[model samples]
Target: MTSVPTVPFHDGQSIPQLGYGVWRVEDDVAADVVAQAIRAGYHHIDTAAIYGNEEGVGRAVAAAGVPREELFITTKVWNSAHGYDEALAALEESLGKLGTDYVDLWLIHWAKPTQGRYVDTWKALIEAQRQGKVRSIGVSNFPAEQLEEIIEATGVVPVIHQVETHPYWQQRELREVEERHGILHESWSPLGQGGELLEDPEITAIAEAHGATPAQVVIAWHLAKGFVVIPKSVTSERIVSNLAAADVELTEDEVARIDALDREDGRIGPDPATIEF
Candidate 1:
């Protein structure tokens, strides 16, 4: 098995460069899926309150036999819970559902700019970190401006920013901002969500040349670009294979070729600027 490397955060902790996400995974089966992922060499698992599967995820973590300190578990606060008091309560509820005293990282699921409470929520996250309830704190689908606002308002910087990123919807501008702030960039829909890019002639050709699947090549591209990639799958073969993709080496030319796939109109997820949810 190939070893997945860890990326350093500005806050003195590191996260696995590759992990498994339980976004659309069913609650009834999330335990088995997460356990299988752990058996396949994944020490990191990403989940959230909105996913409706934290209880199952906690069960898997407890039964996987891996020590609590060895696993990196992350969860998020949903859009509805956006104020300081609500965010604090939200983390407690998530902890109860997850059956854990603390989470490795916690994120505000979305900016919800219309409501304009992300800043207050972020302050709550800072409080969590200070209280030692969360080791790290961040936001998902947040634009650079929002990131800056929270950082300027409070000196704490996010350790990571989770968003929809792929060869098509490459967030070059957002990546730059994260780099400036020393925040790790995390790819949510790293595989393009079954889009045509998965079957594109270029990706297939690259896969054929590398003797790997298009999915593996795409994941390898994400790692080669230094972004944390979480590709989810319930199938046993795919779960194991995705973890082994850490070893699929890509050349400079191949990485650059994939980089060219980014398009201004290629965003498959909602625009962070206007997204109310």
Candidate 2:
């Protein structure tokens, strides 16, 4: 089995630096694909209530033959459940679907600033942690200001902040803010959705030099930058290969070359600041 490094959280817990993300994975096939990922040596599994596959992920966890304590499971509360009571109910529902009494990490899926309820939802996550229903609490797609707002409101900083990040969109400024608060930056679309990013000449050259695939090179870059990354793929071979990225090493220059690929308009996902949902 490959040894994956872990990033420590401010709350004394830790998360695997690399994880399996089941975002677009269908519920029916989630169990099979997640099981394959587990067999490929992935101990971190990222899912969300919006993904609608927590049941399948739970099914795989129950049968993986690996003890539950050894796996890092994460789930998020969706935009619809944005109030304190609603978020609490959402966690209960997710816990039921995941078939676990406590989730390793729970997140508010989006800030939905327009709705003006994320602060209340964040309170719910804080409560969940206090109740021992969640080990760590965090947010996804939350901008730096909102991050500060939540902390000021509750005086509890999120242990992790997940966002769309890749070589094309390095998120340097946001990462700086997170770093100041001791929050880990986790990448969602770490491969830039796997098309243009994997075929970029710079990444391809790095891969060729290392005798690795473009995806591995990119994953290696994420690791080298100390960002927790989750690259999703349903293919069994790709799942295993992605995990092998843990072994791909990159030099400082190569990592800098990839870092220089960041663009002012490289964002491919919804901008959290303006997103309605």
Candidate 3:
């Protein structure tokens, strides 16, 4: 298996450009799937406390005999655990479940702006970093204004901002904001949640040009654009195929063609600043 390149984060550390996302995988199945990914040369695994499968991930990590430092493990604190103390306790719980001493990266799962606790949550995340519970801290689903609030309140810039990004909803404006603050942009739904992106003529054309699949074209676009992408799949064939996407190369014209597929009205997830807890 060929290793993928790593992207440096705001914390002076780096993560694999491609990662495996365990969003909704059941705990019973997560371990084997993770092991499969590891065997396929995936060095990064993205999970969340809410995913309820940290133990499975832990088991796989332990059973694989892979050194902890070689694998980058990331998990997020839930919206309910937003305060300083709650965040600390939640990190401990996550650590316990994952059977690890620390996480490579930790993040606020959502802004939960309506709950009016994200600012405090950001503070808690900073405190967690100071306490050595998490090496790097970031936010998920944060808009520009909310990101500004956290930057102003804590004087710590997020390492990455994970959002529902895909070719359809590119979030160019938000990506600009993230660049201004030196935060890495990560896409949560790079495939548009099984939408028509994989069947688009432009993408298919580019894939055909490179002897790749439409999914590979989309993943290559994300990597080329400097966004960390976590594309999820449980099937072994798809998993292996997705890992192969790193080798796909798209030219400037092909990238521009995929960029043209973005639609102004193609949002798939709720806006963070407006979602209810």
Q: Give the candidate number with the greatest lDDT.
A: 2
Candidate 3 per-residue lDDT, tens place, 226-249, comes to: 989999999998888988999988
Which residue pairs show collisions in model 3? none
**What tens digits encode model 2's per-residue C-alpha lDDT throughout 30-106?**
99999999988999999999999999999999989999999999999999999999999999999999999999999
Query: By the TM-score metric, which is better: model 1 or model 2?
Result: 2
Instruction: Give the distance in Å from residue 235's predicted Cα in candidate 3 to where it truly belongs.
Output: 0.6
lDDT of 1 by residue, 186-256 (tens): 99989996558889888999999989999999999999999999999999999998998898999999998
Model 3 vs truth, CA RMSD: 0.9
- What overall lDDT goes with each candidate model? 0.93, 0.95, 0.90
TM-score of each: 0.98, 0.99, 0.98
Provide the lDDT at 125 for model 3: 82
Residue 183 lDDT in model 2? 95
lDDT of 1 at 92: 99
Candidates sorted by TM-score, descending order? 2, 1, 3
- Descending-lDDT candidate ranking: 2, 1, 3
Residue-level error in angstroms, candidate 2, position 107: 0.5
Which is superior by lDDT, 1 or 2?
2
State residue 140's C-alpha deviation in candidate 1, in Å.
Answer: 0.7
TM-score of 1: 0.98
